[model samples]
Target: MIMIRVILIMLFGRCLSCAICSTFHGWIKKWIQIS
Candidate 1:
């Protein structure tokens, strides 16, 4: 059970980081376009 929970947390963290990275990438692209 504990192992399952740890795996879930790791997956969640990876997904969250991916989302944040994509958002940051989009924002940078917009900023570059504006400039």
Candidate 2:
């Protein structure tokens, strides 16, 4: 689980400046929870 988050961070780290990043992060959290 930690590794998955780490990989996601690496992939999304580049877009941290974007407003949508937070939304995408929330979605990811929800998705993880659902799974």
Candidate 3:
């Protein structure tokens, strides 16, 4: 159903961003330490 699909996209989008930000921050920390 449309409602179900919308909910799934919203939940998945947030989760993806949460994961991305953590990885991005981790890499930034490493890069700063190396430099």
- Can you write out model 3's per-residue Cα lDDT over 1-35, one digit (the tens) per residue? 99967865776567756876567557768999999
Best candidate per lDDT, number?
A: 2
- lDDT tens digits, residue span 1-35, model 1: 99967865776567756876567557768999999
For residue 4, model 1's alpha carbon misses the true position, in angstroms, by 35
Query: Candidate 1 clash total?
Result: 0
- C-alpha lDDT score of every prediction, in listed order: 0.71, 0.81, 0.71
Candidate 3, run of 10 with poorest lDDT: 16-25
Model 1 quality (TM-score): 0.51
Off by over 4 Å in 1: 1-17
Q: What local lDDT does model 2 show for residue 33?
A: 100
Each model's Cα RMSD? 10.9, 4.1, 10.5
TM-score (all chains, Cα) for each model: 0.51, 0.51, 0.51
